[model samples]
Target: MTNETFRALVVEEVNEEIQAGVKACTLEDLSAGDTLIKTSYSGINYKDALATIKNGGVIRSYPMIPGVDAVGEVMETTSDSFKKGDKVVITGNGLGVSHTGGFSEIVRIPNEWVVKLPEGLTEKEAATIGTAGITAVESINELERNGLSDKKARILVTGATGGVGSIAIAMLKSLGYENITALSRKKNEDFLYALGATKVISLDEFMPEKIKPLQKQEYDFVLDTIGGKVLSAILPQINYGGAITLCGNASGIKLETTVLPFILRGIKMLGVDSVQLPNEKKEAIWERIANELDKERLSTIGAVEEPIDRIEEIVTHLLEGTHSGRTLIKM
Candidate 1:
């Protein structure tokens, strides 16, 4: 594959200004790694959208490929874990951040970052789940590990239209957990209900007329994707001994709340980070997504496939929060 030129979305800083576009690049331009992958699919994640912006803080260097997730077949390898033509998937571990990522037709990365594509999933199906699905499952697993039971546990998911929130709702329903409530700014009641949400509420309906340090405990568990004021508002209303998984900052990053909820209610706030999770845990989560997640329902997560060249349009939609569900990039 030496001297081979392929199309990749390149992000560079010219005169302290950020610029991103699809360009023809050779194998030599990629960073040094032990394995080479012929990319088949990638996903448009929120972080990937941010990497294209000037001050998004998602890219650590310039002239880098900006995709946090990829699914493909191994083209060459120096490690014993994979061989030529073996299908694999990779997410996080500095991809599109500190190193060259998966926005290219070819991606070269460390063997340690690759996960053997789980059985019972096609390349496109795996890419559809991508990092968002993994993060959503991780949040649920953390809650269960800490003491979230399926029986009679009233769960609330914020930002329910986004990838993580939507997938979490479906997965929770698949596991037989009823009484799921989804909160979204958009009026997509039909979509949310089809994803198994028993109730759908808008932001204006969920937030009270006045802010308080503590309110009536409305939910037994909260899967919060929108941070900032939403998180602050939800904390005080969590049931005693309940837990909240904080996975995203789509609404904002600032948290203005007190300790009364924690001290008096004994509620737990679990922070989840998919980008830096270990490979073993990632593989485990993928296996669960493949085996346990309702395959037919999982396929209905509103994924739309687009070519790599159209990534800019998808990025614009992501920044404006106009799109729902996952966007798969066929590399």
Candidate 2:
């Protein structure tokens, strides 16, 4: 691939607005780093899609590649952690946000951001899982911290139709958490059931007649991707000594609620930040996701492979909440 130019979805912000296009550049145009990778695949998350909007979604600067998750072979490396041709995966840790991300055929990132792609996961699969996998594993770890058990306590996953929600459900099922309830806006009940959801409730059904400070005891473990009233509503439903992991603020970051869930029910609210997780904990969680996560089931849940140039349209779908599952960008 010497002297060959490749396609990349480059986004530029003008007057505090975002503009995206299929920009072309040589490998030399990539940012300076320890390793240069020929990115085979990258995953499009909400952040990546936001980059194509009128302003920066995750990108801190304009004229930057916008992709948070990528996995490919090393083309060059200066660090001992990796050598040329080493296969690896990367995500989060300010990748698409503050760094020259993974939207192109080539990427340059610190060797510390690189980790050998875990056994049993392909470049495509790793991109499909992306930061969503890390957040799911981290959420479960928090659940375990609060004594999550399989002894009849129900587990509730909100935004069950989303990438993170889908993977979390499968992980819970693999861990023998069968009593799982899924809440989604989609009418595809069978899809949720197939993904190991014991019960599927439409968003309409989930809305309570009256959201009280506390409600009848319910879920022991909760993985929420949508924040706002949905999160506030779920708190009242959490069982005594239960735990909830807050991963995304997609619905809204502004939370207004009383502390009755903590004081009266003794519930634990854990925050998950896959983007800035400590390097050591991130590595441990990545290993767990690679080892314990069912590869077959992960693919079954969702993995859409589209050309990198189609990023403009994908962003609109994701922000509109019309997309489902993980969307992979084939570089």
Candidate 3:
């Protein structure tokens, strides 16, 4: 495979600008790693969309491949943990940020970053879950550990139309959670309902004229993907002893809330990060995701499938927030 070439979407600095397009690459062009994978499918993530734009702050280097999660089969390896023909999945761990990523027909990555595809999960299913699914599952896991045990708890998920929030809703429903509310900027009530949201609230309805330090308590648990004012407004409305798992900042990064919720309500706010988790933890969460999640409901999470060539258009839709659910890239 020395002289073999494959197609990849490369982001390079061209005359002080970021230019991304499909280009031919060789195995030699990839970074040295113990495992070489033939990518079957990859997912389009927010970070991957950002990495293509100029000064998006996702990629620190030019000529990078920007796919954060990939599901594929091992084609070659120098690591004892894996051998040729082994199916695997890779996500986070600097996959698309500091290293060459999954937007290619092939990817050579460190063996430590790889996880064997658990039984009962297809390549498309694994790729559909991708990084967004992992984040959603991890956030739920943290909430469960911190006292979100009531299956009938009133749960609210922000950014409901997005990948993480949609999957979170589906997973929660599959886990037997009764009441789930979705907050979205778009009018996709039916879409949210199909994903098991008991009710869908618009941003306008959710945000009032002003947010008080301690508003009426409503939610038992919140899977917050939109931070900034959304998070600020939500902090005061959490029921006493409830928990909130924050994993995204699509709104903004600032928080202007008082500590009354924490002091008086005894609520817990947990931050979930899927990117830097240890490989063993990732494997465990993935195993739970595979074993515990309903396959039919999980299958509904990925809404679109297109060849890798159509990535740029989907990226544009994702960046514009016009797209919903997950988009899979067939390689």
CA lDDT, every model vs. true structure: 0.91, 0.82, 0.90
- Identify the runs in model 2 with alpha carbons over 4 angstroms from their true place: 1-3, 55-57
Write the residue-wise lDDT of candidate 1 on 1-331 in tens digits: 6877999999999999998999999988788899999999998888899999998978877888999999999999998987999999999999888889989999999999999998999898888889988999999999998788865699999989888998999999988898999999886998888888999999999888777999999999999998988999999999999999999998899998999999999999999999999999999999999888887667778688899889999999999989898898997
**lDDT tens per residue, model 3, 1-331:** 9899999999999899888999999987676688999999998888899999987879998789999989999999888887899999999999988889999999999989999999988888888888999999999999999998888899999999898998899889989999999999996987888888999999999997999999999999999997999999999999999999999887888999988999999999999999998999999988988888888877666558888789999999978878888888889
Candidate with better lDDT, 1 vs 2: 1
Span of ten consecutive residues with least summed lDDT in model 2:
53-62
Clashing pairs in 1: none
Off-target runs (Cα >4 Å) in candidate 1 are none
TM per prediction: 0.98, 0.95, 0.97
Report how far off residue 237 is in candidate 2 (Å): 0.9
For candidate 2, write residues 68-164 as lDDT tens digits.
8889999988888778998988888778777778888898898888878877778887787788888887898888888887646699998887888
Q: Order of candidates by lDDT, top first?
A: 1, 3, 2
User: What local lDDT does model 2 show for residue 110?
Assistant: 88
- For candidate 2, the clash count comes to 3
Of the two candidates 1 and 3, the one with more favorable TM-score, higher being better, is 1
